[model samples]
Target: MNFYTVLEYIGMFLVFVGALFLFLGALGIFRLPDVYNRLQAGTKATTLGAFGAIIGIGLMRPEWLPKAILIAVFILMTNPISSHALARASYRRGIKLWDRSVVDRYGPYLREKEEKEGKR
Candidate 1:
């Protein structure tokens, strides 16, 4: 019936959704066939989940908004970059993809780079 009450409800909903995403991410990590797929699921889902949870907390506590926003921004920036780096390292170290993977755009590029470096 009031603005603060509405915000509290919304915040609770977001926190719940965020928790769900986190649970799904964990499940995906365990269920996926390969490291790449697991990384993808963990990174993307957890990033959104953390964002949602942090923003919900911020909404529920206005005084904590700035810190929450900072943390959210940090997670947003780092999660994907770290995941990509890990994937690339795994690929470079000869990690195999899942059997059902369709395409590999990085293969040719890495090969070419390796060749160029070898020639140098």
Candidate 2:
């Protein structure tokens, strides 16, 4: 096979892998028991899946690689922070968590904020 053809095959393979990850994430979003778990599904898996697809496209289209990489990097930087913000907001608003949830890391933080506000 030619060089471009080989790259195209690899790109297609990566696209398939990405699609699989996206599907898994979607399934998890539906199947998960809590907002935190759903957010985890949406943020991490979807970001990786999207990044994989973009990287695949970049592999197939060398000239577009820079833009693809930038998009992936932007997503990597923002997705987790956004998820964390949403989780914190939900926690603050008293959203119910899964019965199986083991820990509440943000609880102490919120309590501290409440105490500080009360003192103020």
Estimated TM-score per prediction?
0.92, 0.89
User: Which parts of model 1 have CA positions greater than 4 angstroms off?
Assistant: none
Q: What TM-score would you give candidate 2 relative to the actual structure?
A: 0.89
Instruction: List residue ranges in candidate 2 displaced over 4 A.
Output: none
Instruction: Report the number of the highest-TM-score candidate.
Output: 1
Q: Encode model 1's per-residue lDDT on 12-58: one tens digit a residue.
A: 99889999999989999999999999998999899999999998998
lDDT of 2: 0.89
* Cα displacement (Å) at residue 27, model 2: 0.6
Q: Candidate 2, residues 24-110: lDDT per residue as tens digits? A: 889989998899889989888899899899889998998898999999899889989999999989987999789888887777887
lDDT of 2 at 47: 90
Q: Which residue pairs collide, candidate 2?
A: none
